[model samples]
Target chain A: MKKKNICITLMFSLVLGLCACSQESDSDRPERSETEVRKEEVFGEGEKIKLRGVYLNGDEVQNDIMDNYIKKNWTERFPDVEIEWEGTGDLTNLLKTYSATGDLPDIWYSDAASATAIINAGNQLNLADHITEDHFIDHYVNPEALYYSDGGIYAVSSGIDAFYTPAIYYNKKIFEQYELTEPETYDELIQVCQTLIDDGITPISIVGTTGWSVRNFLFFTILMNDDPKAAQALLSNEIDFSDERVVNALKKIEDMLNMGCFPEGVANIDFSTHMALYAEGKTAMIATMSWGYPELETAQDTGVFMWPSSNPQVKTGQVLQIWGSSLNGWAVNSRSENRDLAVQVAEYCTEQEAFRHAAQGSSLNFKTENPAEVTSELEKERMAIYNNAEQYIKTLHLNAMDSAVAAEFATYTNLLLAGDYTAEQFVKDFNPIWKENTWFEK
Target chain B: MNKFYTKKGKLLFALPGLLLFSVFVIYPMIPQILISFQSHNGAEALGYVGWNNYTNLFQSNVFGKVHRNTYFIVGCSLLIALPVSLLLALLLERASAGVRTVFKFGALFPSVLSVTVIGKMWAGIYDADWGMLNSILRGIGMEQLTRSWLTNADTVVPCIAAAFLWQYIGLNCILFYAGIKAIPEQYYEAAIIDGAGFWRASICITIPLLQDIIKYVVIISTLGSMGMYAHILVMTAGGPGDASRSVLYQMYYKAFSMSQFGEGCAIAVIFIIECIIVSIIINKCIAKEPIQY
Candidate 1:
């Protein structure tokens, strides 16, 4: 009887303790909407408001030069609005979890592919509501780039990103050792791969596990046939998946696979391993995006070129570009208690990043003061590719599609690299998947 | 004290555990069931879409493959893990103290290590260019046998199952060892007097008496294999076209990766049913009558 009384007393105390722990302290609660002011007016005066943020590249926030630069500069500009940032390598999965729980961070870094899902979940704030005058959207090199599908500016751009065209970054020393020049066309590239293979070297390595790299190779090949029309048809779902051009593109990739272009077990090779293969001189070439620039720069004697075209009519200068509408940037949580302050933090982060990128002479969709001069040889060459390009075509299939469609695209592409499907089977299998997921009207 | 012995007071003792179970498990399951029948985008239910998610799951090209892979993994755990663990336990029972200690530590080491570390270690072994498996094949003059293990559909599921089995085999063996230690020595001595060797003793005495322990381990192993996600995530990520994907991995991909929460929940419902059915079967078949000393 004494033990039973003790047990009841302990259980009640445990429940009470849980309840006590859950109650918010007086200090933890936000300052609330006491001060409704204009964009220029500072928020939370004499009080600190800490906003939690999760970014795609937030995992390395401490080591990130750009984030640190933004943090130091923003601290001086908005001293009261403190942001407690957390980084994640897998932002999409993180956001999905948060959105389900109705506990999204104050700010999150999102790209075009992921923005639709967040907005559909009603997690994104329409920046237009908060900033009526001097809106950041108006300053964009292309304002439409930041607009949500429903015609509201949901995200603010940090900088104008270059169209993500997967380029072949090669080991210059290896090329020189074999006396090989950069290949100019499909057949030439194949012949170059053959030479490398015969010399007992893998010609290329890709982030095959992710699926996007192989998809880039396929889409770029299709764009080679007729850049703009093919991109538009695919994006708008006007062209069927089993179209001759599409099937032909898949065959070209298959031919490369047959020609011993990629590393053994390419489908399991991740981004870091793929990069390491080139850096370590195990593979002669790597096909990846401009994001590979930093890693490639670190490697000695690395050179870059666009994936060579297959069609006779496709010119040397034609290249794929991510349009302004699909640029990645900062988004404020619509459901946040500190929505007003969150919007301010997001805007400050965006403008600050854009300014820094501008100062660095990187791509900018918006105008800024005193753009830095490009001095590095590699930077000069990259700029030359952009300048010399006949047209900047948007590859909508990869970038501008609904998030689900993009995910399926990656899955199917991974399957293709795995030898699970022939080119014909791939298209037949993917056609229904594409149709099922796509939101765009024909 | 006498008043506390009443039925109402006795039921109060179970209240806390019941409350916790209701709040954590039973409460969430109600909404999950509802969501499985609705069109959800992770955040909230959009509308009723009865049977759509289930129909889609059945219709999906990768669905059949994931199910088959899941069953294959469970089968491996049952067929390979059970017999091998029992054999090892029997061997350990007869071994000297030092050998027993070494064997025990060796068995539990993989179980205690992080799943990520084990998954990654296995991935490295199966890597195509520089992996230990391919290197061994090459060294042994069987270069033709050196194919990418994780990426190939034929070998991918089996490779993952091998890793999963390798992780839990030792722990299961330890459980069997404990059971063996509990069995009466007189039975074994009586068998020895009847000219029974180690094999016959094990077959007749150890196997029959260890039914209860075997049943428990079999159920746990089967259910654990069915619900596995992390190893697949770290190794192949349900890739090479979802050829190596399990039911849990597919649910994760559908819900988190693609934000098809409705479909994911439907998978969860089916998974729960599958687990319950499997547990019932294991209970019925393994130890119909509870064994007593």
Candidate 2:
């Protein structure tokens, strides 16, 4: 009995040792074959060039209008080219992860800052050689809009220009009832706000919790009161954030909060509720971008005006501009066998006719010629803004900084919105780090 | 002589388990200790940074806040959850056999649901715009008292702890109930015959009998609270400026989001040591001789 038990225990130990060894070998064996499979699967379409494109879906032109229309129309136009569209969550992070894995799609859309990072990481193809001087005029593209870094064109600017305006999008009925005209200046706007408040309306339904929306107010104040070049100078370290102009901008926001211009519990209200309050006519005006027009169209009788600024020199309709990169353009993967077909398909999609169609759906792109018909009134209004675009000054935060610096900016903004750090403290905390770590030396 | 050898052989049969414990648990711990000495980016090992990571952790404002919040939450959960579960278990153990089974099964219902689902349900209940709690508060003419419970730093931790308590109370109750039922009824009968009242019998017979189960519960509960992750991640997301960020959440953020793998490993190593120390202290404080009866 004793010998039998000892023998059983020894057998069990030997079996366990063999199992663990086999498991280790099995795990290690997959990688060699897996790489071969991945390479063949990703690049195996020899004649049929299937270009995968990832885009965001929403009411915005990129999603609701541009992507949907492209999916429907592009297939009919290009019978030979197979375009596979995949909508992804968190486009920036997805692209970054793809770049890290070296399994990037043929084409992807990203902001200028992210584009810079992708280029720095050596994943993006240089398109300057492909794009001729005549192509800009022929395609009705604005040559100046293409982003240039270190004196070389890296990405094409999307024709759609988000001409950001910190405008008072007021209900026409409410404005008329309160006897309010388009406020001529910042002080006059304050007076209009007071009048609306006295009439039992929440003056401005500013969404403080949505950091981006709250930031628009700050951007507007800075652009209007300070020099237009102030942002660029600060980013380049020519001017400090502690400068008088920046401080004044923050103080103005504080003053606005203290004056009860915004609704009570504005800090807690999210973007949806803020819009809902405005849409329901509980609020007199909402300070938002031109992108807000589609949502406001459903609300009763709305009109837009340029926000009045403290500086008279800063022109009316002049607001902060967040430009989209043409770098979001398509590129054929070097490893792909169907490279020629992919390039041909990319050219066809970006052709004048398709560009015009895409422009109609989105407000960002500038069209070479006016479309035969404008589908939405908001589109028509946006087109008018683009036609008269020389009147407005453009600005962007992340686009102006290095990729890493821009990420830091986003982090700091999140921190500021959380109320853990004040705006002034945020600038002080970041400026030194920005000066030290930036790729751009003074 | 042959029978003695057989009994010794039977004792040696536990060797496989011991070997597994060494390989899986003990072997991996060696690498963790080594990783604590290195600096790591997301992709590659970035050489030793001495004690920089630890020093940085000590200096961080958010880390200090998260540590305090975690202890407070754990303390509050234990104070309310443990006593209530014990009482419920004791009551159910004394009931009829059928009633005892039904109660035991019913108590396990919440534990059947995933932590994510429980978190979502609680978030909805506490939502500022349309939460049931705020709606009820408003209906009772206490509208001013209604606030965004999850967003506020003062109430967010307690609100989350209450959710944790609700989810785990059933499981703990079942554990205590099983422990109580396992005890022989002869001691209780003898106590009753000796003119011992219900309270006195409970203190002398029932409580002492549950000493082992009580020790196990305390150790498990302490470890569970220390390593709590899923509920906080799904519900609060360490939000409102890291008000309810626990050590596990911070460790995860370091490993995945920030991509500081070495520091994350270091955190895990320290966390294990802290848990062990805590367990030892608790054992010492509550040490008692086992009652064979």
- Top DockQ prediction, candidate number: 1
Worst 10 residues of 1 chain A by lDDT: A34-43
Per-residue accuracy of model 2 over A272-385 as CA lDDT, tens digit each: 667888899888888776667768878858876656657777654454444444455444343333443444444554553245545556543445454456666654665564
Considering every candidate listed, which one attains the maximal TM-score?
Answer: 1
DockQ, candidate no. 2: 0.15
Using Cα atoms with residue i matched to residue i, what is each candidate's TM-score against the true structure?
A: 0.89, 0.71
**Residue A207 lDDT in candidate 1:** 82
The stretch of ten residues in a row with the least summed lDDT in candidate 1 chain B is B18-27
Model 1 per-residue lDDT tens digits across residues A113-219 = 55666777677877876654546566666666655556687777655555445577888998999999988787788888999999999998888885757665555
Candidate 2 lDDT at A406 equals: 48
User: Against the unseen true structure, what C-alpha lDDT does each candidate score?
Assistant: 0.77, 0.63
